[model samples]
Target: MDSPTNSQKTVSDDEEIDYSIKPELYDSDLDDKDEQWMAKKRDGRTSDAVLSCPACFTTVCYECQRHEQYVTQYRAVFVVNCEVDKDRVFQPNAIPSKVGKRTRDSEKQETGSADNERLNPVFCATCSTEIGVVDIEEIYHFFNVIPSEP
Candidate 1:
């Protein structure tokens, strides 16, 4: 049998696909972490290594931190160990959603220390997604930063 001649033009011969509307779809600068994050996102999942808001993909904390655990069901209970960590993880406008006063007794019962402090729920400033709760010690307890199993 005789072979057929090639008719189709290759991508290199044609104009590049217009990804201007969604440039991120064709972003060539995506690093390994970003690629992993994108893959996880496509699979309807998330990663603890990159603490970003699942709704808006706003990074709350980056990797390479020595914090206790960025990924956990305890709502990042020990993630922000101190003010420095808090400053690193949360932005300045990342304030509490609401304030609720907790008695020292109840606080002690829950955290094993008696210190009167107001507990507040932290929400994403961009999407207003309920990220987590700030406990008496100013530690974040994320409820659904990413829809991941812990």
Candidate 2:
């Protein structure tokens, strides 16, 4: 019997493309000390601190230098209150819904994801500077700001 020609050979149905490369592991050691420090500074302020530029819908935390300077030089600081309320200081159109949704989903999939609350950084209305952020579960409270010395 003669061997099969190139065009006469039978092809197997179980052949599959191989894609067995192992995924690369991510290193989580990037320096986040600055962010941690900033968050800590913002969380250390008292609630009685006078809110500046209250009409502007943005949060102001004590961790920001501009807020600190305003408090130091003028004895009072002004910040845009970005909390969601009747006045709505933050622009609804400016919020990125898709990004926020994706982040929320990712957090849900990770371990130790019990904390469902989210916080977004607030921006100054006039200069567009980041003054602080609002914690969703914290009763619309602002965290982090440069406070004037008492």
Candidate 3:
């Protein structure tokens, strides 16, 4: 009888060989079909809401996604449901007459024009879509009042 070489492994009738090393060799079509099925499964939903700039009418959500420095002046107010507390919310402080005057004067002094006003987000005047949140201090401030947990 000839002795087996190191490259040749002896297999008995009861031995099981693992063919999983070349998984792609077995199911190329099945893998492609699975990818197609996943792509189809992922295409059924639309966004319930969208954010746009009040002045420019451009989609500002992408800009808001990036972290930016913002000054939270008392004039610019926003209403937001607290994610953690649930019950309490922050509403924009009413623009005080004195504060408004100061802001206007400051703008006039710095820019030589009184057009540097912070646009307050209200209901989209054109689309009538409710402004659900305002981005301030790089945080999303939700307007929906959250119910308190018992």
What order do candidates take by TM-score, descending?
1, 2, 3
RMSD of each: 13.1, 21.5, 16.4
- Report the lDDT tens digits of candidate 2 across residue range 5-25: 989988775564334744366
Q: Estimate each model's TM-score.
A: 0.38, 0.26, 0.20
Give the alpha carbon lDDT tens digit for every residue of 1-150 in model 3: 888886787777546655556755577689789757644643542222333534435332311121234222111122221112223233456644554444666755874432232223434334444443333332443232111111
- Comparison by lDDT, 1 against 3, better one: 1
What is the TM-score of candidate 2?
A: 0.26
**Candidate that would win on lDDT:** 1
lDDT per prediction? 0.51, 0.43, 0.37
Of candidates 2 and 1, the better by lDDT:
1
Name the better of 1 and 2 by TM-score: 1
Error of 3 at 84 (Å): 31
